[model samples]
Target: MLELDASAHPGGIALWGAVLAVYDTSSMPPEIGIHVHARSTREGDKQVDDTFDTVVVKLSPDEQATITGDTAINFYLSRFLNRDIKLLRCPHCDEAHLDAGYFAVRPHRRHMCQACGRQFNDSEKSISNPVSLLKRVHYDVPPVRAPRNLDVKQTSYPGGMQIWASNPALVWTSARAEEAGLHIHLYDSQGNIVVDDTFDHVEVDGIELNEVHVQYFMAQQALPHLSEKIVSLTCPRCDRPHFDTGDSAFFPHVEHTCEHCNEKFVSKGRRKLVVSNPFEAVRKSLRANWQSHRI
Candidate 1:
């Protein structure tokens, strides 16, 4: 018998990763099973949908020799079918798979089937229902930990705000800001005050000020400060170190593309600053920003 566990981003058809465990019903031991961890991505050809790029196969050393060609093929076929790795066929014609690029455009609300020329909306209902070849195996993991030290500061200019952190682990929340005794405000490019309110929470992308969406815009403006303190990690694919900073740093489940090879990988663990004097670091950062403003 085969048991499959899978997970994906919300509204995303692509499966981020999946675990497939094969067990003999008669000899089912909680600890013993053929385990495979497959990580899926759409890195290379953007036109192509998700594909399994990395796979970690785990089996007992004793059972390793028992795996034959037929068994291997069956195992892999089951794994693929369980994870929904197949392309999505057009419901209208069932001839060609829908192009992700065309469907991704916001204005193209309804996707026209290339073969049938029938336009259909990829509605929430359609998205929720995927063609599954095998019974879904329910498996879930704890949510990723929120980044630490997501500090927000009211900017020198009225209605202007900035979010900063020493590392990429910082996740900003309205509650965290409030705890830090900070107030939320919106400002324009010209430093004109836009909105000043006492709101309980602020959705990064939901707030609009002066006809402009402020979702992560303010956080982006303040990212450079944190970038200076970013630590580098060696890319598993390229074997070259890449800086863990910029937009990729803050978001979860987002992969960082290597600058050299363009190989994309997610930062799994947290990297922290070993500051003997954190106060000095803060003062220096502030001083540097102050000097830059004058210049």
Candidate 2:
């Protein structure tokens, strides 16, 4: 039997506080269940006790090996909670699980593996190679607006170009920008086009940015852009919007904290809008196919 426990930190909802996972190997197939403890608070004085909710899954032999070997328990909890929870396991040793506390080192943001004593930098290459944890599951999701290919062209000025896309999320990466020539003149909803100097930065869900990247940006920057373009929910406490910005997994969950009030909330795995761009959709499909081939 393998058991895992997790609790939400202060300022987060009590329902997110308590989580438990149990996997029994003795059974022929294998029995697994995830339990979440929820509590309601009264406005006055009396406090309500905790109530339990559970999701049970039966596993095949291959799936059992996947649960025990490759994935972490938080991955399962993310599925149950329908929110993205960040969990790190050592890439070097592949055994030791690293928590937020493990990244306490400053300046370089380097991580030293406790199990293997391997030191590594927090770069795009390292962060992208997370251990696979979640299995395929079906869910009914809403459709997003389809992304039309932008007509990107070079301008007479050095490092200058013109581009237009219906999806605001479709921004060129540093490499793609350089490949197409820089100093882009973006086309607005109107037929008129303007340079970055003249273009107004769009603000969505309280986030304003001059540019967005397709990949290779830190979570801090990427999450905000994703929140604006993708599905988002407002905080019940402070009324600030929060976004889900985790990798594409079937019914993936993401945990979020409000910037204004510091209240925490979890996304319930339902996207109000999906990525409709063919480029992004194809990229996701290819990536999924590659990952499956690798596994």
Best candidate according to TM-score:
2
lDDT of 2 by residue, 185-259 (tens): 433334344433212233221322223222211122122233433343577788754433334312224555665
Instruction: Give the Cα lDDT of each candidate.
Output: 0.31, 0.30
Pairs clashing within candidate 1: 147-169
Give model 1's TM-score versus the native structure. 0.21
Off by over 4 Å in 1: 1-88, 91-93, 96-111, 114-116, 120-139, 150-295
lDDT of 2: 0.30
Candidate 2 Cα misplacement greater than 4 A, ranges: 1-58, 65-97, 101-109, 122-131, 141-295
| lDDT tens digits by residue: candidate 1, 121-148 | 6543221112122222222322222332
Total clashes, candidate 1?
A: 1
